[model samples]
Target: MDFARGTKLTIKYNGNVMEVTYISRDEDYLTVKLQNGYNITIPENKIDVLKSSEPQTVKKKRITLKHGNGTPISLITTGGTIVSAIDYETGAVHPSTDIRRIIDRYPYMEEKYTIAVREFDNILSENMQPEMWIKLAGVVKEELGKSHGVVVSHGTDTMSYTASALAFMFESLTGPVIMVGSQRSSDRPSSDSFGNMEGAMAFSSTNVGEICISMHSGTSDNSISLHRGTRTRKMHSTRRDAFRTVSGKPIAEFKNKNVDFLSEYKEKSDKISLSDKIEEAVSMVYFHPGLSGQDLEKLSEGKRAIIIMGTGLGHISQSLFPSVRKIMSMGTKVVMTTQCMAGRVNLNVYSTGRELKKIGVVSAGNMLPEVALTKAMYLLGNYPDEDFESMMNMNMRGEIMEREFLGDCY
Candidate 1:
């Protein structure tokens, strides 16, 4: 009855015999993972264990790193699902920063590329902060100096935010800086981590010099998309193709170990430089129905810059106009972005928008709310106070689109 975790078991449940992997158990129930990658909990008395075997210990073949004749690439691991594996004992996915474990999974990488490995941090992407972005920028700059390109393995949840922050921090790059993540952890059969990482490796060998996210183009594994970091957003929660480019096309696509350019991209620069300063006092608020001026004031209090994700074309409740004016008068920059998924924020289309802008709510034209937040942080951290408004409107790092096109929304 005391089966170890990962022990193979043959059990009779509901008069049917099945083989499952023992995960965990409690006083009232037993938990096991089916062959199809799903966990089920059954009443302790409802199943009869027919046989059990000890967990298998398979010796993995060690893959030694060697410099190859291909492009030099650095693999930076910052904890995420891409670097996580299931802990059978707890039935929970735990992240790992072991570069050897990762590299061992794909030994072909060592055969095709001169690979360098760095364990940046092993924290989830949600725990990422502006200070970490600055530090990451420094590490990336150092790695870029030695490698032809860099591939960052990150958690999918906040990958876009980090990618956007990096895009703004590094004005120019000598090689492609591709951030990659997987919706499914690498241990599962449906895992996209392999394809995404392979795509990142392939794209990194190219001459593209901008920060971009490499993810599945669709549910199928045939192709992967390269999205501009600032223009990308994680659209689906658990889909293989979660990240999408908003209001624009993907920069490129990778298939058959080759990268095909889909849109104009920044080629490699002569030298790399970074503006790592970031203002942590920026806050982003989503405008909701019945939100009071006091609510806005409380949220915007003591923040240097506040990004309001306003309703349709960036219109806030006219009732909150006084609070917006007060926040701006106190030297806190107020920028408006759309709550809608795809479209530019137009202040001249509606009277409420006009009123908000007249009182000094700068429009974050077509920039995603999350992107606007990072851009505000970047601008506030490095630029003078007077230059904030003008720079916000400027299309820096492709965050803003000059024209809207049909069929751009997903």
Candidate 2:
């Protein structure tokens, strides 16, 4: 029998009859996703494929609920694993685009906030770009005007970038713009979607006027950490608590449906503003051994800025100094940040660092490279004629940490 991709098959394997979703295979093994929600490889010769057919779709009963009186919030759904389901035909998880399943799981949300939801996009966050960032910022700004707060259901891969972009785009916010994502798909028992959504909504209802990400506080699902948008980064690939606030403290923590402030927040004013224009012609170069400036010459051709993730207090190999100087001559702004997550870029510490500064390489005080890139784009867009060297060194948001959090315990 001939079978194609997306075929549902009934097979006899090891003297037992079982049903599985046929994915693909190599020379010796067949890949299949079991009903147990895991992909496994079975020996092709050990299983007899007795039957194959297109799977039938079973419609689910939708649950409808009335709006609550607690606080008005908007749910902006961008495609992510949090709103994804197993595609049995392909044996891959894909975005469902239906957010009601997320809402139904959290019945308590109905009692606290009148939620207004919108499906903004349905693509994986890896495909996210500067255009999408601008569009999302527009949607968020528009939502914040009408709703008390907004919860953005996003994919974890690029959620930090989006959060940082939103932080720079929206200058004045009256309520929280909360971004949430999950490490596992919602169907998995270990999924962090429900807890994260709950925490995001809980924090959004508060008067915190900032852009933040709400995610699992730790490996367990007991609480969620609220990291400031510009300071957060995804540290691990598949951990529930992947995001951490780099060089700064989290603004708050949410537990048992309550937000406890970890630090002071700026007072919310009646005036709200947005600076959504972004300069996308920027590149982040990770400098390493044997890497020459010729490798980065093309990136500076039509770019407004280049952020270098340098090693050890922001020093690149001296071989790249000519390229760095050439980039400066081309009128491209150069900013240096540490590949080290916890420390500041001290170009004044070494002779090479001082020479780079003389060549107009600006140091990013303790900002993550990711945050530095977005912040550079923001500054270039909004203040093109102004001095970026001064602005880059200045602490615009909580992205720059004044001192070590734990007092050099490391």
RMSD of each: 6.8, 5.3
Candidate with top lDDT is 1
Per-residue accuracy of model 2 over 1-410 as CA lDDT, tens digit each: 33554678899998998888887788889888776867888888899988888755434322223466768887787878775677654676655645567568876666777777666877789999998999988888888887889889899998888898888888788888899999987778998988898889888888888899999988998889998888888988988989988756678998876789988776555767888899998899998898867788976789989999999899999999889888888889999998885878898989999999899888997888999999999999889545788888787767777885763211
- Tens-digit lDDT track for model 1 on 176-202? 999999998777899999889889989
In terms of lDDT, the poorest run of 10 residues in model 1 is: 58-67
How many residue pairs of model 2 clash at the backbone?
0
lDDT of every model, 2 decimals: 0.87, 0.82
Q: How many pairs of residues collide in each model?
A: 0, 0
TM-score of each: 0.82, 0.82
| lDDT of candidate model 2 versus the reference | 0.82
